[model samples]
Target: MISPEERNRTGRGCLLGNWVEERATTSLDKTGPESDIHKKGHQGILTVDWSSKLEDTSTQKSAFTSSKGTSAQQKGFRYELMKEHLIKSISEQVHAELTAKPAAAELHSVTRRDYTAGGFQWVRPTPSTDRDYKTDQAITFWRENFDKIQGVTAVRNRDAPFKKNASFTCPITECLDPNPENDLDTEEK
Candidate 1:
């Protein structure tokens, strides 16, 4: 069977494109006055869900950037993206699992009150061998999903509270004291 891209190359993809186009255009061909229900059914469902998810991810990314990420246990894009990809795959798997369940079957789940700081943490089933070399594949994945992560910061101190350069004692007092050679009093202080 020809893929969408292959079909498009031969100009036989009109029907597939039309189907997708029609789904998108369903909301625009409205006859009656604007109603929330109609909008929700046609446009709101996919648009609202996707946009809100993207927005949340964007916010997390912005927050992460302003704050620094962990240094010691710093994970590279290869590991992190692999984890993210696996997560997406597992979630799709679970969804598929649930979908496969009989209509009348009851679904049961255990509930627990968790206190983890970061939310999107996932365990990798398969680990990469080379831990030294900087791989382009991981970096590419990082760049691609960098925007999707809401709170994955590139900054140095992700946990450091937003300070206007307040002269608080070093967060890790035992390790080192917070001091600067050039005491340029910025607004953050």
Candidate 2:
């Protein structure tokens, strides 16, 4: 079967997923009150009931980010959350950002350092002969170190673009004097 992309491009084949909607709300929902009750028949027989009582929707609503993301799109970013060191420029900036736009901290989560850090990016075994390399130098480095990078020794899904679910992505990255140097001020964990 021809995909949606081919159908859209060629303009000759029939497509089932053709209709596009500006607004996703249903006809019944748009007509009147937006109550939680769901009716199946014409007599308005209630077909659904809430399993758990929701006193407030604040927790659920905070999970969604309404704003369209920024220029830091697709790029891996490093941000600092201010707690102890108020003297640093980035820490002060982060606090200021949260103060000005409180909604910026929505969907914020604490993650493990080793899991998300780039230092642990290539922990898997060496790539097989079937895998494709991004570049000659990259392949050479991988083969020598027995390390493989994504979209090179491994495949990356090319369907839809990946997006960060967090709001207010600050492009600011604070490094010491040099980009490669580690901060000497950090305490031992």
- Where model 1 places Cα greater than 4 Å from the true spot, the runs are 1-73, 101-189
Kindly list the per-residue Cα lDDT of model 1 for residues 65-128, writing each as its tens digit: 6656557767776999899999999999999998895678545444333444557677877756
Task: Predict model 2's lDDT versus the native.
Answer: 0.40
Candidate no. 1 TM-score: 0.16
lDDT of 2 by residue, 8-55 (tens): 453454343432221222333344433432343222223344464545
Given candidate 1, what's the lDDT at residue 4?
35
Question: For each candidate, C-alpha RMSD in Å?
Answer: 45.6, 45.5
lDDT of 2 at 36: 39
lDDT of 2 at 14: 31
Query: What TM-score does each of the candidates earn?
Result: 0.16, 0.11
